[model samples]
Target: MDFYLTALLQGLCLSGIALGIYISMKIFNIPDITTDGSYTLGGAVTGMLLSNHLPIGIVLPVVIIAGGLAGVFTGLIHTKLKINPLLSGILVMTGLYSINLSIMGRSNIPLLNYTTLFDSFHFIADLNWNSLIVLLFIGTLLILLIGYILKSDYGITMRATGNSEKMVSALGVNIDRIKIVGLGFANALTAVSGFLMTQFQGFTDINMGIGIVIVGLGSVIIADTFINWMNISSIWISLILVCLGAILFQLVLAFTLSIGIDPTLLKLITALFVLSIVSLPRLNLTRN
Candidate 1:
């Protein structure tokens, strides 16, 4: 039971990143790989600030802004320099590796003795339960916030930019500006995930964000599958499904572990699962 509960919390932790990826891939139609670096940058910033006794309030905004800046950098490269979007993300992500290292001043930072966002909550007696409650609240709030934004006027423009960039441009909208803001917002959410995970795991590792993009992509794919099947058109419902998809993804991993799979094969399993999710939907369409 505890194992499963942990997986639930883990899902909540990853929810922010999943939303970030969804915003980029689904809304903007941009494969913003900057999530890889921005996630770790969030952890690095959080860990460094907490270890230095910084206020939690200050720490969070700083981490979010840092993540946003990284996205802005990638957006600039792609839009201003005319670099391919994928290559621009790669360049920024690669640079963030070194930046994260410098921020941490080490390869890892332990937070066993420090207070975290989980410490402020007491809705449950068990540590894990309390953590779960806090995570659930935060996750719900984030999903609502994103959902609201996506249903707004600016969000219409952002979504339109992805769906018909040429048309939006023809309307005298600054496509480049929209892309920058959208990407920046996406990465900021990714960074929030990193911040939460680092605190939950009790340590921050320089390489923790490695391949995190894949996890986010998998969650998005899973969410997309369910959303399509339900034929849900409400933005709020879509956002909720995205978070549920993250939870479902984690639950699958937990079940896999319960079955005694070799830990070394976890990455392979993740890759295979994501591949299946990506392919199965198209296969179903073909059969229809």
Candidate 2:
């Protein structure tokens, strides 16, 4: 039960990345693999600040800006250089490895002895429950903010840009700017996940974000599946479902571990699990 509870907590923390991926993939129709690097960048920033005894309030904005800039870098490469979006993300992600390392000044930064945003949250007596409470509180605020933005006039244009770039461009909108801003928004949210996870887990490793994009991809896929099944059109509902999908994905892995799956095979399992989610929708289409 405790193991499952931990998984739930982690899933909640990870929902930020899912939300980020939701924006980049579902909204922009771009597979911004920069998520891998931006995530660790967030962790690196948080770890460096926290370990230096800096306050979370100061650390939070810096993390967001760092992540957003990384995304913007990817956007610039893709839009200006006319490179493939996927390749652009790959290049930015590769470059961010060194940037993240330089920021942290080391391969790993431990924060167990330092105070954290999570540690400051203590609504209940039970430590786990408190963490859960704070996570939900923050998550709710994030969802509301993101939902409002997506429904805004500018956000509508952003979505339209994704649906049909030519249509958006025909409206005299700067399609390139929209794409860049959208990617910036996406990766900033990804950094928020790194912020939460580093504090919760008590350490940050340079390699912590390797293959992490799949987690967001898997969660967004689950959310996409649910939206299609339920015919959900509301942005608010979709964001909530994305968060739930993130939790569900983690729960599935937790169950796998509970059933005695080798931890060494976890990455393989993650890949297979995401593959199943991706394939299931197509399989349903074929069956129909």
Candidate 3:
């Protein structure tokens, strides 16, 4: 029971990353790999600040800004230098490895002895359950905020920019600027996941974000599956489905572990699962 509970909290923490990936890949149609680096950057920033006795209020915003900066850098490289978006993301992600290292000044940091945002509340009987509650509240707030943004005028334009860049440009909109803002917003959400996960696990590591993008991609794929199957047209409904996808993904992993799957093989299993999701639609199309 405790194991499943932990997985639930973990999924909620990572839902932010799923939503961020949805923005970059689904909404903006940009394969921004910067999420790998920016996620670690968020953890690095949070760990460093908390170690120095910083307040959670300040720490959260700063970590978000750091992540946003990484996205903006990738956006600038792609837009200004005319680099491919994939390569631009790669460059920024590569640089962020060093940047995250410098920020932490070490490979890992443990926060078992430090106070975290989750410590502020003591409403639940079980400590782990209490943290889960807090994470639930935070996750709900994040989903609502993102949903509101997607329904806004600027967000519509961002979606338009992704759907038809030439048409958006023809409308006299600065498509490049929209891309930059969209990427920045996506990365900021991803960083929030990093921050929450660091606090939840009571430790932060430089390599903790390695291959995290795959997990997020899996979540987005699951979300897309539901959206297509249900014919979901509302932006809010789509975002909610994305959150559900994140939870379901984690639950599936938990079930795998419960069934005695080797931890070493978990990555392989995850990759295979994502590959199946990616290929199934195309397979259906071929059959048709």
Candidate-wise lDDT, in order: 0.93, 0.94, 0.92
lDDT per residue (tens digit) for residues 246-282 in model 1? 9998999999999999989999999999999999989
Question: What TM-score do all the candidates reach, one by one?
Answer: 0.98, 0.99, 0.98
RMSD of each: 0.8, 0.8, 1.0
Candidates 2 and 3 compared by TM-score, better number: 2
C-alpha lDDT of residue 75 in model 1: 93
Residue-level lDDT tens digits of model 2 in 157-225:
989999999988988999999999999999999999999999989999999999999999999999999
Model 1 TM-score? 0.98
The total number of steric clashes, by the backbone 3 Å criterion, in model 2 comes to 0
Q: Order the candidates by lDDT, highest first.
A: 2, 1, 3
The regions of model 2 sitting more than 4 angstroms off are none
> For this target, which candidate reaches the highest lDDT against the unseen true structure?
2
Which 10 consecutive residues of model 3 have the lowest summed lDDT? Answer: 117-126
